[model samples]
Target: MMGLPANRLFCLVLLFLFVPAAVCGASVTRTLSTAEPGAGEVFTVSLSIDGIDLGGVVETLPTGYAFAGTDHPDDRVLVRGQKIGFAVMNDTAITYSVTAPASGSGDITGTWEDFLDETDGEVAVSHVAVDGIETAAESAGEKPAAQEAAPRFAVVAAAAALLLAGRGGRR
Candidate 1:
């Protein structure tokens, strides 16, 4: 039989695993090709989707920004005013183009909905910087990708250590 401490430790490990998953069950990251675009310039916004398979994305563009085109199928694409929706069924990565206004700087917001799971969440916001403009992430010194991954790495390392300790006590 598992002792109280071991049982509690096991529960703690499960909590650590499930909490992050429930909070960030799935993720959608938006990236702009041209960091800073000239007035009337065309640029691309790519979405890197993870943990989603049968749903869609709805993006709301900044005022004056125009939806140009995309590689996603036409039947799955819908543009209404500044709001654009695309059915990303089975697509893990997709790219769409947009026309920067004569001059503007604003963030693009989006939401992802999983049809099968009936789950939806906000996507990470992306800034459209007109020439001479700086994004929020740029204004603040950006951290290296490795630095950003450190937290997840730490969590994984801690979990592995706990598992090893648990096994060491067994038998």
Candidate 2:
């Protein structure tokens, strides 16, 4: 009857407001495969999220870190799947490959913003330290000097061979 309809409308309104808040309370987890990375070496950064919708999920990578790609286990739908028996809207597990430049300790941080659809309730920011490639001197050592000398030696030998060939032709 008319009372039943009114009750249903009130419940629907409550759900609409409260559900978004609950959904936006997302959790973010980040893991680094290795703390120390050599120059040009590809390493993995694993990111997992529970709660928010994939469509609304925005991952912000720190400066100097390139976004290799993203991975989602449940590709069939926008929402990944359920977690802990509760409906997890956007349950995504992503692996990002990053290359560290130079040799030093670099800080990499990721922010999962707008998780709960609430403007300010983003999940905790995760940070990882990447050890840059060892110093050039330590890595290459005397090899670079040798490599540089090799080309010069080749050039000199070629010049000497050309001069000898010309003298023989004249003789």
List TM-scores for all candidates, in order: 0.68, 0.42
- Per residue, candidate 2 scores C-alpha lDDT tens digits across 1-171 of 235445445555555555445443565666778766655457787767655573233444443445444344434313221111112355566565666544444344334544345432233344433453444334554221221212243345445544544454342
Candidate 2: segments with Cα more than 4 A from true spot: 1-24, 54-64, 72-89, 114-116, 119-171
Considering only N, C-alpha and C atoms within 3 Å, which residue pairs clash in candidate 1? Answer: none
Which stretches of model 1 miss by more than 4 angstroms?
1-17, 134-171
TM-score of 2: 0.42
State each model's CA lDDT, in order: 0.77, 0.46
Relative to the unseen true structure, what is the C-alpha lDDT of residue 157 in candidate 2, on a scale of 0 to 100?
A: 48
lDDT of model 2, residue 103: 40
Residue-pair clashes per candidate: 0, 1
Candidate 1 TM-score over all chains jointly = 0.68
